[model samples]
Each structure stands twice: as C-alpha cells, then as structure tokens.
Target: MASKQQTVASFVETAPPGELSNVVADIKALAPSEAQALAPAYKKYNEEQYITVKLPDGNGTAILSPYNSLDNNRYFDTATETSFEVDHASQKTSNPQPHALETPHADLLRNLHKALTTTSSEHFPTSSHTITPTNTDPSTLTILLVATKFSPQNFWNARWRSTYTYNPSTTTLAGSVKVDVHYYEDGNVRMNTRKEFASREVSGGAEAVGREIAKLENKFQEDLNRGFGVLGEGCFKSLRRQLPVTRQRMEWEKFQGYRLGQDIGGGRAK
Candidate 1:
C-alpha cells in the first residue's frame, strides 16, 4: 500500500518524517529555474512564496508569486514562472494584470486634491484660482463654495473650484484627507466627478471610499445645476449685448470681410 500525502499546515504543526524537507523540495520544484537561483521559500498562498526573478540575457525584469486561499496538499503552486513581457506602467509588472483599475478621471481628481490641500489661494488670483481654507485638518472634511465665475464681457469661458477635507470621523478614517472641486470650461459644460484612494491603509478600505465618493458626486450634481443656471444667464446677457444692430453704419470701420459702408462697394478692405 502507498503512504498518503501529508498537507503543509499539518506538516508545520507536527514534524512528520522528512516531510519538512519534502515541502521545501516541492516548492523548489514548482518554482521556476529563476526562482531557484533566488532560493524561494514555501509560501502559504498559491503553494509558492513570492520571488523576484530576472532574465539572464537582458534588463528584462519580473516578480512572480503563487497565491492560494487555503492550505491543501493537492493545490500547491506548480511551475511558477515569469514572462519576458512587462508593462512599465505597472509596478507589479510580473503580475499577469494591472493591480488597480485606474478610471479615466484619475488625473483630474488627483490635480483637484493636490491644489485644494497644499497650495494657497493667492498664487493665481485671476482666470483660475485655488481657495485656501483657514482651518485644515487630517480629519474633518468640509467643502466651501469659494467662487465660480462666468466672464461677463466674454461668456465663452467659465470656471469654478473649491477646497474640502474628505474625512470627518478621526477614529473611523485613516490616512490624511484631500478633496478639491474643479471646473473646466470646454465648448459644453457638464460636471462629472470621481474619486480614488491611495495605497495607505484606510478604516473601511474601498467600501468606505465608495460611500464617500457617492456622497460627493451627489453633492457635486446639486451645486452643478445651480452654477449652470447662473452661468447660462450670464452667457445670454453677453450674447444679447454682442448681437448685431441694424442701423450702425456711420464711418469706415471693420465690418464683415467686405467694405460695406456708404462709399465703399462690396470689396475686400485693406
């Protein structure tokens, strides 16, 4: 009769006959030749330990690790290897896929957070500006409606920005909070908001972050509607002011592309 295989956890708890060495040997076998060079230890997850391995030929790099949820002798890591292909964008380039799902609004949100928390308001006082808060804390997030402007003379441009701290309950929130409200004027203006968390440990992790952002987006929409209405009125005022009048040809002035005054027939003006 054949002897039954022992599990890693069981082997750890009880020193079985030559089984410890066998487990190490098993890891060595399953791990790649590159991992062998580094001498990988038996890991709990995926039956393989984390190892950093590189190609002998060139500057190519990769980190490969096997992961498993539970300890089972049947499901040990087998033949762990790193591919030559790597995305420089991914710090964990050895992993098959990117770690964090970076949404499209990442850049915009990052800039907003940066400007609101650290910089002072007086830096750029015109066209675009950042509003400085008198009281700032790691916890206690607050948003102030600083200033939003639509150009009275030229309504083609419009913008708004504000500062806020993202956390209220210090006990519940870990990591410093940063929040910024940003408005950019394109041809058509519709407000959109997004949020992302950094690697630092948070109180509730992603779940907490999701809840906070949902609240922020809703708040953003409410204010956005109000701002839109006011800015729209400004745009209409400017447009009406700039509307062409019927009786206004007294002198030789720039009008259309042609010389359309009393003496000047329809011809290109110099």
Candidate 2:
C-alpha cells in the first residue's frame, strides 16, 4: 500500500498540466464558505460554557453538556462576569451591555474626556471622543482626530488617536498617542508613544491626586497643541516623501548638468 504522502506525490506527478492548479483553485474557492460556517461556531463557543464527558457504556463516545445547566431548563445563560484567583490576587472582568459611568473615578475620566475633546478639536475639526471599557476601574478615555486633504485627490488619509487614564489610587496619569498616515500607493507612517506621570507630593491623598490630575490635564493640553504641529511636520515631510520610492518628486535642478543639452564628456552645451 502506498503511503499517504507518496500517494499525493504520485497523483501530482500523473495529473495533467493545470490539474493540480485546478485542485488548488477549487480549495481556495471553498475558503470563503468554510470561513463563513466557522465564524458563527467560534462566536457561539466563546459565548457559551460547555463540558465534554465520556459515556460509561461506550468506547470513544462523549457528549457536550451546558455547564451547570438545570435539568428542567432547555437553555441556560452563562454568567457575564468571570473571576479567577492567582497567588492571593483576585482578578475579575465582565462582559456586559454598555452602562453609564457614575463612579467618582468615572467622573474624573469624564472630565478628562471633555478636555481632550476640546483640545483635539482645535487642530482636527472632525474628531470623536469616547470612554471605553465602562466596566473597568480607571476607564480609558480616547479622542480620535482625522484629516484628509484633496490636493492629491483621495491619495492619502491621516489620523491621530490619543488615550488617557488616571488612577487615583496609584496617583498616576498615563497617556497613549498614536499617529497613522496611509497612502494609496502602498505606503504608511505610524508613530506611537506611551508615558506615565506620577504625583510629586509626599502625601498620596485625595488632594494630591487631584493636583496631579489638574497638572496632567494642563500638560496634555500643551502637548496636544505642540504635538499636532510636530506630527504635521513629520508625517507630511519626513517619511511620506521617502516611502513608495516611485512617488518621490525628482529634483530636476540637480540633474540639469546631466541632461542631453548640458555639458557631457568634457563638451559644453552649444
């Protein structure tokens, strides 16, 4: 009997020209249908809890049952929040519907979110603000600004997304800034930075944390004002001109001496 690999090799060797290619094309054609069928199964498995158990009366037989399902119930809803303990530290995360931000920490995030929106709107008129992961402590506040110029007629798009978080318990302020410039000619420039600032006061109380928040707000506002200028300069000039080498504008003046009418082979132009 031929081995599996040898059998495949023999089939490939004996097939007419393009038969192997046709087989590969057919497989590629089925990928979309396979992916479509798999996507829902993946989502369902992720959202539902199940356990596989062996049957006592049969060999290689098993059944998947909903975890902790009631015998009288046909369907069960899984818990929204997951919790685990690791080395005395308990961590919990929730997957629930969006809710309002009402905690004191959320109040601080809301204030920062408002300020960031005000700051970014100055440079980018088309900007959006959102507070993400409303369930997490010290929720992330993000502002995204997008700008596109039609000088090249839909040849490029640029965007800047900035995220900030303040933790009152730790007296720390964190910022993540990202800039992306994508060109239609298969070119891109990306810049990202993450930094944290701590309070300088010896007392790590509410007043100290408040001061840190005020200072961070001011500092970030100034950075936004200056950073937009720097990004504009960097993105449109530095890397944008260098990538997709075919898009560069040639310096005709520098090559004037090598042109047909110019001096060549020790002979001057007439």
Q: Which lDDT tens digits does candidate 1 get at residues 88-192?
A: 112122223222312233333344344433332432243221111113341233222222333424423222333233342341322222222323344433333
lDDT of 2 by residue, 1-270 (tens): 975444443433332211334433443465533332332232233112121222222222111222222232221211111111111011111222223443455455555545544554555554444433323442422222222222235445454444444445554555544444445445433333433444233245333433444465457658867987897797646755453234545566775556544433334666
Q: Which ten residues in a row have the lowest lDDT in candidate 1?
A: 68-77
Considering every candidate listed, which one attains the maximal lDDT?
Answer: 2
Candidate 2, 49: how far from true, in Å? 29
TM-score of each: 0.24, 0.36
| Span of 10 residues, lowest total lDDT, candidate 2 | 83-92
Clashes of each: 4, 0
C-alpha-based local distance difference test score of model 1: 0.32
